[model samples]
Target: MKKVLLYLKSYWKFALLAALLMGVEVTMDLLQPKLMEKIIDIGIAGMNLDFVLKTCLLMIGITIIGLFGGVGCSIFSTIAAQNIGADLRNDLFAKIQSFSFKNLDELNTGNLITVLTNDINTIQRIIMMGLAMMVRSPLLVIGSFIMAIITIPKLSWIIVLITPIIVAVLLTVNKRVYPLFYKVQQKLDQINTVIQENLAGIRVVKAFVRSNHEKERFRQSNEDYMLANITANQTMAVVMPLMILILNLAIVAVVWFGGIEINQGNLQAGSVIAFINYLMRLLQSLTMLGMVLIDISRATVSANRVENILKIEPTIKADHKQDDTFEIKGQIIFEDVSFSYDEDGEPTLSNLNFTIEAGETVGILGETGSGKSTLIQLIPRLYDVSSGRILIDGRDITEISPKTLRKQIGLVLQEAILFSGTIKENIGFGTGQISDQEMVEAAQIAQAEEFISSFKDSYDSPLSQRGVNLSGGQKQRLSIARTLALKTPILIFDDSTSAVDTKTESLILEALQQKRKDTTNIIIAQRISSIIEADKILVLEDGQITAIGTHQELLTTSKIYQDIYNSQFAKEEKNYA
Candidate 1:
């Protein structure tokens, strides 16, 4: 909570101004009860019409001054709170962008979204409320209490007796509701997770006829979220009535005792009336403060959540001390590299020792879960090796800046992700600037230009979110085109062409060989034909390299490669027959 409050440092002036204005409003409010006492005891009792009228005018003028203070406070508080929210949100997003793949994996997308949007909004509102009421309530309470004591010191014991009970109630409610609000935020995360999953995979749900199942899943999550909210609100709702009951009882005690004092010679009617007014102001301010404290409790929970994100240092940070001015030649060496998603778990790629020379085309063949994707991911430093080192050129990859290193390597993940935009924008998403000729050339190389040109708008055609309007093959082609546009010295395709036809895949591979011959290429593919002509192929089984040779050499040298080639070849022959 304290860490998150630093966001207000830049806007503290506005917050302080708001608080000062609120104090003006509270001062006016406190003075009004005392003026009423003057009107009753001095002006009315003495039968002086001029004094009564003059005091009434003064009260009206004070009310007008207070109105300006209240309005100014609102404007400044909004400025302070809104700016703080925006700055905090922007910083949080920037921090998330700096996170490594492992960090992202550790933080759930749903939870991150909830914290960035809902939790931040909660803190923003509390800041606004606090800036206004935080000053007003305490000043009003203290001023009113002092005036009440000065008015009738004997009657002040009623307030002294009631204050402890209100404080006790407030403390109890605060303890009970903090955990509930925390649960509410967690439930909201679950709701968001369910919604995000359903939307992202809606096509799969429809294809599998699992819409009903998804609906049930969403229904259950929503209900849980709703129940959590209701439980928290119900706890707060109970506190409100209990507080009002205590307040009303205190007021009744004041009225009862004040009547007795008035009947005696100790208190006048005007004094009794003023004392009741002061008592109401003081107690009501305490109640309002109680409500603000409850809100502060919720905001504290949200602050901690936001603070947790801000406190996280990205697992991978670029070393600025290393000289990164040297040009990359695309020679990648993995020396005794090993990695695991979990520290205690088995290594996903154990003792990976390989060297791909500059401008060489290397194909990686592995069974499912052989860590093919993981291996490619390591090349881009998406996830660093748990043990050992990767060398680019001759320097350890850790010595190079990640941004500079990634710029020289073009990676196409197994899943092709496209943002909502025109085809041209999608192609230029990474490089930022591409001439029409360059864009067309990349699309052609990926075997995507033919289908793309068929559209009325061609490259200008708009794409739905994640390119849902395009086929799997088209999206994969676009993904390849996007990466190919970079024209990096090192290219990695992690099953990027699997969805395209064999002929299209062949064409793309031929294009890559012709156009990027001077660039190193690493391809991970399931099909033997896709990698048959490669200069070298790696056969992997259970995260270990079983074979490394040309296709014909592998057929004779490696049992795993032979088995894969024979099974695939036999299936093709049987289909043709």
Candidate 2:
């Protein structure tokens, strides 16, 4: 709550101004009822035209002031709400971007989306209403009650007795509705998760012929969301009718008691009428107060959800301060490194140690879950090691700022992710300017030049989200081109060439040899031929290094390497005929 409140501190002055205008509006409303009593008893009944005219003109002027006050209050409230909302949305997105892979694993994407959009909008609406009616409604309720008591003192006890009963009923109804709203938010998160999963993997879903199953899944989530909302609405629906019923009983008491006083010559007709008007205002404000409390109840749940995200301290922050001017030459060393996704679970990569001198190409071969991807991810500090240390140029990676560290390293994951933009823009995304010559060189190395040039727009052709318009091999090459364009000292490819043919893969490797021979490279591949010619290869089994040698050295000494070599090459030799 405190973290969420800090976002509103900058807009406090505007919020206050809007609340003050709302107070003025409420004050104008209260004064008119009192003036009506005078117009009825003193002007109309007394046969005085001059006094009636003056009072009517005064009422008209006050009404205009009230109208202007309401309009000004709404304008100010909107400004304050929008400013807070923009700041909050930007802050939430920035915080999410700051999260490490581990942090993301703890918080799912669908929940984050729900909080950023729906929950933040909920808080914004509350701010607008809090600035406008939240202040005025309570004031009007209190002022109306006091004026009613003054107008008919003998019947004032009727209001005093009934106010507590109305309040109790409101509290009873609101308590049940308040807790149900949390379930509504949770259900919304589930629905968003299903929708995001379906859209993101639509190809896999349809290819597997699971469309009916997916539809059922979505139907279940949608039905749950609707039911949760229906329950909340049904619970809140009791407050208004319950409030009006209690109010009518109070009104009946006031009218009956006041009639006796009027018959006894203790109260004037004007006083009875004024008291009834004040009672109406009192009931109306009380009704609005009930509705606002319900709004606050729901908004409170959303605020807490939003506040949870704001309060998360990234576990993988760069806590080790170091001199910013130090240069790194990309000499990577892993000493007794171990890592686990769960703190208490078994390590994914355990007690592994290796070194790579600058400009050396190292290949990693391992089966799935053998920690091939996890090994390279540690060098960039995407997830910190559970134990031991990694040093770049003899400096512990903890000491290097993530921005500076990642600036010097380029990574291409197994799944390529491309934004919706021109091919030139994607390759030049982080490298600043890319002359036609630089782009062509990078594309040639990635083996993407032939296909990209085939398009009418060439380098200017636009891509869809995640490069969906491109084929699997084309997407991988474009992804490779993007990384190659960075011109970083250290580049890591984690099974990034699985989709390309052997011939294209060989051509891409040949192009890289000619264009970027000096760049330190680490290639992780499932196929033996992909990494057989590396300067050194590390064979992994169950997170342990079983063998580390050149292809020729491992072909004689390591049985696993021999099996992999034979399995991939024997088939190719047979197909050559």
Candidate 3:
């Protein structure tokens, strides 16, 4: 609750104005019953028509004032709530962006999506309801109690006696419902996780003909979510009816006692009527207050979830002094580097020592799970080495800021991902501003220009989400083109050309050799042909570098490299035969 209140500090003025309006509205509401009492007792009782007419008009005017105040407060509260939600969401997104790869790995994409969208919405509603009702409901309850005492002192004991019971019941219900609401939210996150997985893997599910199995999984999650919500709401369902029952009983007691007083000529009819109105208003306010508590409980859980993410300190911090003024020479050296995904996990890479000189190309070959991808990931500090250091141009990678280090390297991953946008925008993603010639040249280098030109809109053609409209080879080519357009000094291609044909692959390699004279290239590939001409080749086996030398040197000296080469070329030799 305190954390949520702190978020509203930026909009204190709007909150204050809303409070003031609510106060005015409550004051006007309290005055209305009193004026009605005056019209009935002083004017009607004395048969004074002018006084009754005037009091009625005054009551109407006060009603209008109350209505205006109510609307004004609502508008202010809504605007304040929206602004707070927007600011909080923006801050959350920025914080997520700043987190290191390890941080993101700890938080799954689906859970983060839930926090950003659903949880934020819950907090917004709570803010709006809390601000709007916090002042008015309490004021109505307390004001009506005081007004009731003054109007009919004998009957005021009934309110004093019954109000405590009602409060106790509400508190009990809140205590039980609060934990259930938290559980409901957890179930909702699970449902979201299931939905997200299904959408992302829908093709795989269909390929395996497991749609029914997936549907059952989703149905189970949805059922759990429904059951949780139903349980929470069912518990809360006790509140309003019990409140109405207590209110009716209080009304019965008032009328029964007031009739006796009226027969004895001790209490007037107008005062009794006014007291009943005040009691009903008091009950209505109390109901709204109970509802507010329910919202606050749910919001409290949601705010805590959001705050947890916001409070996560990034593992990687940028150096304040590091700047991009110095140009990269594209030299990279890893000295006895070791790494693991987690503290408890076995090392993924061990004693990894290698060096690639400026303008040189190095090829990395390893079986799956041999840490080939993990090795390159360390170059940009995506995941820091658990031991040893990586250097670029004799400067430790850690000493350089991530922004500067990444700006010097262009990477193409095994899975080519594209956002929903035009081809031109996807190619020029983070370059700030790009010229048409540069975009075209990069596309041509990656052999993507031919297909791009075939499109009716050329570079302006809209891409579906994740470039779903493009073929696997086209997407891979575009991803390569996107990275190439950055023109960074260090290029890391992690099996990015696996989808391209042998002819196209040759063309891309030729282009890289011609255009990347000053760029250090790191190629991770399964095909020996992709790296046979490299300056150096390193063969990894079970997280250890078993062989490191030129392709011909390894082929002659290393049995593992020799076997891999023979196995691949043997197939080609048979095809020629």
Candidate 4:
């Protein structure tokens, strides 16, 4: 709640003005009934035409003024609510952007999307109503009550008796529905997660012929969300009927007693009419007020969810004082670094120590789960070392902020992710000021130029979400091109070229050798042919570096390396026969 309210401070002035205008509107609404009393009891009773016309003109003037006040209230409330929403949305997205990979693991992508879009929109609706209807409803209720008491004291007891029952009803409904609303939101997250997975893996689902299975899966999630929503609505659905019953009963009591008052000369006919008018207005306000409270109940749940995002401190804190202008020459050192996803679980990489000189090409080869990806990720502080330290250019990487360090290192992970954009735009994503020539050069190096030019639009060809229009190998090559365009001193390919064939992979490696030979390159590959020419090859088995030497030296000394070589090239050599 504290964090969520911080956004309101920026628009408090507009909100205050909206509240003031709403007050004026409600005040004018209250005044009209009193003016009706005077026009009926005095002007019409005495048949004073001038007095009636004067009151009529005055009422028209007040109505027009109230209309302007209502319009102004609406305008200011809209501006304030929209600006606050925009700020909240932007701030939330930026916060998510700074979250560590570990943080993302806790908050799934679907839940984060729901909070950013749907939850924030809920807060906006509540804010807009809070500034507009929230102010008007309470004012009208209180003003009507006070005016009814002053106008006809004899009939005001009914209002006093009825108000408490309505308040109790609202409070009861709020309590019963708040927890149910939270469940509804979680159900919504589940529905969104199911949809996201289906769409992202639509091809896999189709190839496996699981459309009917997927439909049933989605149907179950949807039914759960529907059930949760209906349960919450069922609890809250009683509020209006109870309020109306109480309000109508109060009106009945007013009419019953006021008739006797008028018959006994204790109340004027006009006074009874005016009191009834105030009662109806109070009824309308209370009805709206009930809905406002229900919405407020729901909004509070969303507010807490959004606030959790704002309140959670990122696991990774960047060093603000680090010099952004400082350069990295790509000299890397890892001394006894150990890491595990779960702190209590077995280490992914344990007590590993290695050094790569500047402008060196080091190869990392291991079986699955040997932590090849984890090893390269530590250099950029994607995940900090669990035990020891990593150094770049003789400075501790942890001492250097992630932003400053990552800018000099380019990483292409095993997964190929591309946004919906032009081929040139995707390649030039991070490399600012990339001309057509640079785009072409980067594509050539990644060996993606031929297929890109085959399309009629060439670099301008549009891409769909995740570049689904491209084949797996094309996506990987495009990802590589994006990294190469940055021209960073250090590049880590975490099996990024696995989808590309050996011929294209050979061409890409050859291009990298000619174009960026001085760049410190780290290659994580399964095939032995890919890393045979590396200056130093580290053979990893079960998170331990068993051999650190040239490929030739590993073949002679490390049985694991020899076995891998035999499984790959030795079989290939025999197949050629």
Better of 1 and 4 by TM-score: 1
Q: What does candidate 2's lDDT look like per residue over 1-577, in tens digits?
A: 5677677789888888898888889889988878888888798889898999999999999999999889889999999988988998999999999999999899978888898999889988988987798988899999999898888888888788878887788778777877788788889999999998899999999999999999999999999999999999998878778777877887788778878887888876777788888888887888788879888877888888888898898987755475455566768898999999899998898888888888888899988989999999999899999999999989988888887888888999888889899999988877889888888888999999999999999999999887889999999999999899888889999999999998899898877777888888899998888887888899999888889989999999999999988987898899996
Q: What is the C-alpha lDDT of each candidate?
A: 0.90, 0.87, 0.91, 0.89
Clashes of each: 0, 0, 0, 0
TM values, all candidates: 0.97, 0.97, 0.98, 0.96
Flag regions of model 2 displaced more than 4 Å: none
Q: What lDDT tens digits, residue by residue, belong to model 3 across residues 1-577? A: 5766687999999988888998889999999889988888899999999999999999999999999888989889998999999998999999999999999889987789999999999989888878889898999999999999999999889999988898898889988999999999999999899899899999899999999999999999999999999999999998888988998999899999999999999988899999999999998898889889889889989998998998999988787777556568899999999999998799999998888999899999989989899989999889999999998998988878888889889999889999999999999996977899999999999999999999999999999999999999999999999999999999999999999987899899999898877789999999999998999999999889999999889978999999999998999889779
Worst 10 residues of 2 by lDDT: 318-327
Clashes of 4: 0
Kindly report which residue stretches of model 1 are placed more than 4 angstroms away from their true locations once superposed.
none
**What are the per-residue Cα lDDT tens digits for candidate 4 across 1-577?**
5677678899999999999999989999999999999999999988998999999999999999999889999999988889988999998999998988777778877888889989999998889888999999999999999999999987777888877777777777777887898899999999999998898899899999999999999999999999999999998788777777777787778888998988888877788888888988887798788778878878888898898998878887786776677699989999998999878999999999999998898999999889999899889888878999998998988888788888899999889999999999999998766999899999999999999999999999999989999999999999999999999999999998899998899899989999998899999998878888899999888898989999889989999888898889778889887
Residue ranges of candidate 4 with Cα displaced over 4 Å: none
lDDT score, candidate 4 = 0.89
Winner of 1 and 2 under lDDT:
1
Candidate 3 local distance difference test against the native: 0.91
C-alpha positional error of residue 424 in candidate 4 after TM-score superposition, expressed in Å? 1.3
